[model samples]
Target: MVTDTDGYIHLVQYLTEHLGIFENSQQQATAEDTVMELFEAQLAAQILLVCGQNPSLTFAQRNLIIREVDSIVYDLEEIFASVSTDKATPEQTMFITEFSGLIKNLFDQEIAKLHLA
Candidate 1:
């Protein structure tokens, strides 16, 4: 979990530095959507890191990872639900798709690790 935490912090820093670029791009015009997309990406990266670290995780660590992933997914879903139709944009769809892909990749990796283990 220590490595996962370090990786998540690094990803947050990287995303923070690159957020301006992502926002300025034509893909995301509104600040709200941009912020949400950035958060989704950050969460996705954290999940990826956690999954990558799962192979060596103890039972307690596995439980922690599951809890963290569930929390992130729940929060993300709530945010998606709260987005008004007026604010709904193609960027949100793209962001969600990308985030989902990251999650799927993490799950796949974790499954592969389990098979190896």
Candidate 2:
């Protein structure tokens, strides 16, 4: 699992950076949605991986974690939605997507370990 929280902070920073000027609001909205979706997926995967790693966790504990993750992500979405995307660098956007995938792969590795063990 991705134990470091820096990835999450960087995601927020990259997303807050202004994006390319869109031809229309629809285009901008789509770009924002894509970025947010990838971010949310990464967050969920990391949290789930951590919860899964602890085999001793009770059902209620697992459920609590899931619910907390969902709540936190929802709050972040609201915050990110308000950030203006007037001029984002391509590198920042690319990094967000790529980093998200990398974290997810880490989570996947943890799952594979569970099965193999």
Candidate 3:
């Protein structure tokens, strides 16, 4: 069986390749709301994978995951605020908003599952 970290790396690689968020040309652009959204989503996935698999982890470890997720959310909010009106295309903005929501849902689901077990 694959370890949680290995699974996360595979998932991140798959998401990066299929989502085209940070592809060759895409990386040249300055960081944007969409880029931050993708980054937060990846972080959330990592947290979910870790917590979901290691329910027996120490309290400190769980707190660390929560702290990391909170930091990502804060950074994402900063990115959203800094986007210029002209650069914040409607489609891109919408995608980021939806993606962030999906990431949050995944986190909630995983946490709930842990509690229920």
Could you say which candidate leads in lDDT? 2
lDDT of 1 at 30: 51
Q: Note each model's CA RMSD in angstroms.
A: 7.8, 7.1, 8.6
Q: Each model's C-alpha lDDT?
A: 0.51, 0.53, 0.52
Which pairs clash in the backbone of model 1? none
Model 2 per-residue lDDT tens digits across residues 56-98: 6667756755665566567556765644333333444565556
- Candidates in order, TM-scores: namely 0.39, 0.46, 0.39
lDDT of 1: 0.51
Candidate 1 positional error at 14, Å: 7.1
> How do these models rank on TM-score, best leading?
2, 1, 3
Winner of 1 and 2 under lDDT: 2
Q: How are the candidates ranked when ordered by lDDT, highest leading?
A: 2, 3, 1
Residue 36 error for model 3, in Å? 3.2
Winner by TM-score: 2
Error of 2 at 39 (Å): 1.3
Model 3 residue 23 distance off true place after TM-score fit, in angstroms: 9.2
Angstrom error of the Cα, residue 12, model 2: value is 8.7
User: What TM-score quantifies how close candidate 3 is to the native fold?
Assistant: 0.39
